[model samples]
Target: MASSNNQQPSPNTHHNPLFDEFRWVIQIRHSLEEDHDDDIGIPVSIFNVPKPLQLSKPEAYVPQLIALGPYHHWRPELYEMERYKLAAARRTQKHFHSIKLPQLVEQFTKLEHKIRAHYHRYLDFSGETLSWMMAVDASFLREFLQVYAVEEEEEGKALRRLSSRMSHLVDYTGRKSAHNVILRDIMMLENQLPLFLLRKIMELQCSSTDAADEKLAKMVTSLLKELSPFKLMENFPCIDVTQHAHLLELLYCVIVPQSDEQTEDNEIEEQNDDAGAPKEGRQSYGNSGHVKQLFNSVWNVGSTLNGAPVRFIRGIIVSRPVKFVVQLPWKILTGLPGFSILKQPVEYVFSLQGGQENTKVSNPLDASVSRPPLVEEIMIPSVTELISSGVKFSPTNGDLTTIAFDVKTVTFHLPTVSLDVNSDVILRNLVAYEASAAMGPLVFTRYTELMNGIIDTEEDVRLLRERGVVLNRMKSDAQVAKLWNGMSRSVRLTRVPFLDKAIEDANKYHDGRWRVKTGRFMKRYVFGSWQVLTFVAAILLLLLTGLQAFCSVYTCSRWFGGVMNNVQKQN
Candidate 1:
């Protein structure tokens, strides 16, 4: 009877599928809990480049010359730099006298978990491997900085000793040649050590007399300035030791520096905006009080001083619903020289510029030369199209931080931007860093977006070149246009503070019936061909001649007929 009952199929066996499902859920829950705890207070500096952003330019974000961190430490192509890394490590040991590789490895071993926490991706290397990697890479970086320091301190000493790839590194930063690919590699967000690690190494390396942090800042800034394609504005933001999270963060600070007051103002403005924010696509700028906030008062007032001008309806008016009374004759108003500048002191006093109440700190990033606030919507015509539409391009003395399009003057004031082989890698990495940063200022990204919209063809590049806005060291103008076009694919468009006004002005101009029709006419008829124009002119001339001939013949016939009739009457 017991055998018969057992053969009837055990009750638990029938419910095995349910038990397996329960076990699976339990495992998933445990994993979720473990991940949550692991993520607590993790210092997220290096991030795996998001898939969407990487699709545009994958190679740009990855290191090609040297690997700085555990992320790409053992890539086969990059294995060539391993020997250079070893050489750098040896130099580092020799410089420090007693400090050896084993001691550095020990330090790294103790700080492994903390270092690992900074990276968002799961690293496959075991504790021993990670520690060894950090030691070697950190040594390489420290020695790299030492090379720069030695070069600056004792000019020709380090130059003679540098070999192979190290020799190329020096040249890349100095002359900017084919080997300058290394410059882009080192600046990538993924290829970074924790600033704390570098700081620790600096502290160890510096003698009791030297200011380590100051020296470190100078070294980093000097290195970055050498590699950067963008011109660093004079008195550009100084690197604060307290502010940087990593090397990439340091680069970011140099690229986009904001004063403490400005940062606070931005934060307060953001909070206020968030407090009253509406649903997406329903944002009203008119009531938000930031619509005409493109340029600082300095720019508007400066533009006014130059003949191209802007007048504040605010402060000048005594009451609500301010009235502007212009009672001058049209000829006098239009032709009178310096008429706009008659009330220079009064206009300056009653300006609506933001920093009027207090003496404002000058922003190095601000446009050095001021132009009138753009009146039309931002129309980003191709460089060729803009030139065809009577817009002139002029080179600004200022850097890229001061790029402006003035509609009133019909001129685009742009800093001379260099386009070369290294430009793509440099720009792509800058864009990637900006995209990944927690609170990255989108200055470079915005500039790229603006350029992308304007440059649709090689002709645009040619126009920019003619105007001296671009210094093309690359293969072709088409490549320049293509580079800009490729950049904005993954970038989510957002409102850029200064560019909003320019964009509005451009859109208004592009969308205007007169401008569109005139452009079309020029492209279709006037600018089409000389043969077409000549043929049309000849046809008109033939028609006029035929009419003249007919009139002359008719007049003669009438005169002859009148004479005949008179003769008949006399007979």
Candidate 2:
């Protein structure tokens, strides 16, 4: 009894593994419940970069020049940008008459809870720290946009000072510019300020007038325009800007707008739908249909499925002419109405049959009908193979809406993409955003995937360069190929049927067995050298001549023997 009182009880008394595990399970469940209770609202748009994708290419997803949001706000590498942020904050204060920087900080401080709810990951900063970060970022962004918004005369002094400050970031002989890197960083998916702050800041800065809304729109549009490679900003359709969540969403809307007409059409189609089956014009191109389309492309080869000989057309006329010599002539040509008329054919040819058309045709090549569901896999010929197969590649007018593939013409139209130092950064962020967003357009992702499949080697890059499809500003073609191939490391593709169908068609045309066999035979034994073809022709001619001579000799011998035998018998 004394031993039982003084000594420890049996080791199994309180050391049950099952009980320990059960307690752990309860603790985990309680923690998860606490986390769920802490979450106040639904986070739909902005998201942290998935671990797999981030791990694959961390540098591309992470910002280099600046950190605009809380995700990278505390990183040691981004400390250099903090001074610039402070400078931007000081500049931003001058823009506001009523609200000073401290007042603005106070305003964001009051809305700390609301702002924190937007981020997907748990931010580690306290409320005060979080608000301060938001205030600083918001102020810098406004000033940055304002600098680009105002005219040269209005912002000349500011621009010069800004340039002076930024000059240290880039060397004079360097391939990249500081401004481009900043633009790329700002466009990153995770490094975005909340749209509410942008609007509120704009409101505080605007005059008390109805033009305030238009003023805000114009400012945002101009800022986005200066950053984009495509200058079609002016043509962007009016959208409810209030629906946008951030700069990335605004940029996306400007690029791939869901027009009111399209919305009405979708509604009408939905109303008319009878069961789960799609209507005549809206049929989904399932696996079977995709295969048939592929077969058709291969079967037709250089022609359409209906046996019509297709005409090849260049999408954009590439001219890096001797500028010193041709500039004067080009300027003169530009002055003429006839020259403008000639230019219209190339610029507006694809747009005439763009997605706005109303007709519903069964043919995938017809632009009047909705495009078929893209193939399950993305496939296209390498640049070298496409050139060898007689397919032409030309640049588009920097608008992705112009991306089209005409199997009838055996031509592929792509945007005149400038492959600068920031191209990879800009493209990858856009892809990451698309992957994260609930319904982000997959246009950019599909384009990169298509480019990756086609640019497998340096030869492919050379061919693309020659065709003016890729204006590679980088050091080498291998670098260009590597940039694209690495972009799709962990990307998940959705069904963008038109893009899929186009790529599949291109692959089918290039990889068709019959076409491949014929090309090989011509390139190897016959077209290997002119001498080989001449030798084969000579051998065939000699053989034919020898056979004719042999037949003639045999006939003469038989006739002579028969005549001799008849004469002898008669005697």
Candidate 3:
């Protein structure tokens, strides 16, 4: 490549083909109409991912659409709730007549307890539990999202009219739960998530047409809010929805490249990703500065068997303001962490060229790196604690009710100091993100004394605050930031062998690292060669022994088990 220039690439133009194709993807995503029981993998709630253009397969583009949104993150969580709701519903309804509401409540409560207990059962000292958890969650959610089609034709017909209405009603209530009767009742009972969903359905059914429309829109918007982790990020306990993003990205890292022809089809892929590839390159120039919905944003670019220009786009529209940084917000991290989060927006303006193939930090538009904490880390804690401290979750039974709250002031903890977002030195090292981000907060804070090789549990990714690693990450940043401020630009942030030192191996990491692909390949070859030699030698020895046996038999010597050397060849 030619020497890089200081010039920055252009942002999204108001309207163009590549940009349009990307817009088309977003439109298709905004229009995803799914059934309440549909098993669309991603939550039907995150939106605005631009579809990718077809460089080679323009024809295939007719039949395929590109979908990129909370495909990894939000979909899985929704899927879990979907799966848990469906399964719990299934289990409860299985032996229907004999089961009473009290029994159902008791059974579901046990299940909720079980799920929590099973989740925390194994905590090893390796940080690789992240990878392991990824595998398990994917499988569990898959099973969870199987979308059990309830067999109630009459009820279904009734639900159809009311379902959309209730959706609107829930939206109208927006964070106003007390006004909604059924929802309030379920919440009071500490009822299952499915119950909450069903209550939401029931409320939608009871809503007025005009009133419900606004409410449902607001309700969908509220759900979409959770798809993003912004509101609760202010007083986060740890990394929020960031892990979910990593999980989804990791899954894409696997599924996107493995596609072949129709033969190996998993059946469900046709219903899911296959339906979403078309709308690439087809966005309308009609609407500008418009806010769109993006629930489970999916983009496909292809024609189905009959060829009706099929483009499947699914996702939720997100209206939440993007907060690119969330951990302690830098200002709270006191010393080092404070310095890391303060970079102005212009810092990341240069590398927008090719973040795709280059997963390299140098790619001006590397979108996969850090942005904010995930749901589990920040939102759940915030919501849960908010209610505990002062926000009330009233789960009532009959006339008597109980409120769940343990009010307390939350402590603010920033994710330690590191390079600012606009830092050019940091963007070029994309591969090292996983390795470095593991300790992102710690290393940024220069807390190595706390991070020495010992891993308390797999989640102990606090290596970012350690001193050695911190000083190491900053050398290049110091020069870049200073240069921008008209200080000396002579300092170079020396690239360290980060990905090389990415892992640790106490009881801390998984065995998969040493057992990587190359090692396995070489091991197979080595075993194959050894097995071949052993086989050949065995055959030769057998032949030689046969000859010896023949002589022994001929000489009337005992052999063959000398089984008398085959009874002396049947003498």
TM-score for candidate 2, please give it.
Answer: 0.60
Judge candidate 1 at residue 290 and give its lDDT: 23
Superposed by TM-score, candidate 2 places the C-alpha of residue 382 at a distance from the truth, in angstroms, of 0.9
Model 2: per-residue Cα lDDT at residue 228: 53
Q: Rank the candidates by lDDT, best first.
A: 2, 1, 3
369, model 1: CA deviation in Å?
25
**Residue-wise lDDT of candidate 2 within 1-571, one digit each (tens)?**
8887769677667665434566566656654565444445446556787776678778877888789988888789887889888877776677786678788878887776568677767765455677778878987776666544566576555546564565555322233477667777888888888877867777676775344456666667766664454543345555455667788767765665343333222211222233223323332222222223332344466443221112211111113432222344433443565343223222222222221242442333333123323322234557777877877777666466566667778888776665767767667766777667735335666767787877888888887777777778789988888877777642543434456567756654554435664565567546675655675677788867865775565554453577788999999
lDDT per residue as tens, model 3, 351-450: 1111222354342111211111111111122222222233322222211001112223222122222332222211211112222222122121111111
Q: What is the TM-score of each candidate against the true structure?
A: 0.61, 0.60, 0.16
Best-fitting candidate, measured by lDDT?
2
**Comparing 2 and 3 by TM-score, which wins?**
2
**RMSD (Cα, Å) of candidate 2?**
19.0
What is the per-residue lDDT of model 1 for residues 138-243, given as tens digits with 9 covering 90 to 100?
7777666654455555656666666656776655235645246666677777887877677666666677424668777777777766555555256655676645
Q: What lDDT score belongs to each candidate, Candidate 1 first?
A: 0.60, 0.61, 0.26
Which structure is stronger by TM-score: 1 or 2?
A: 1
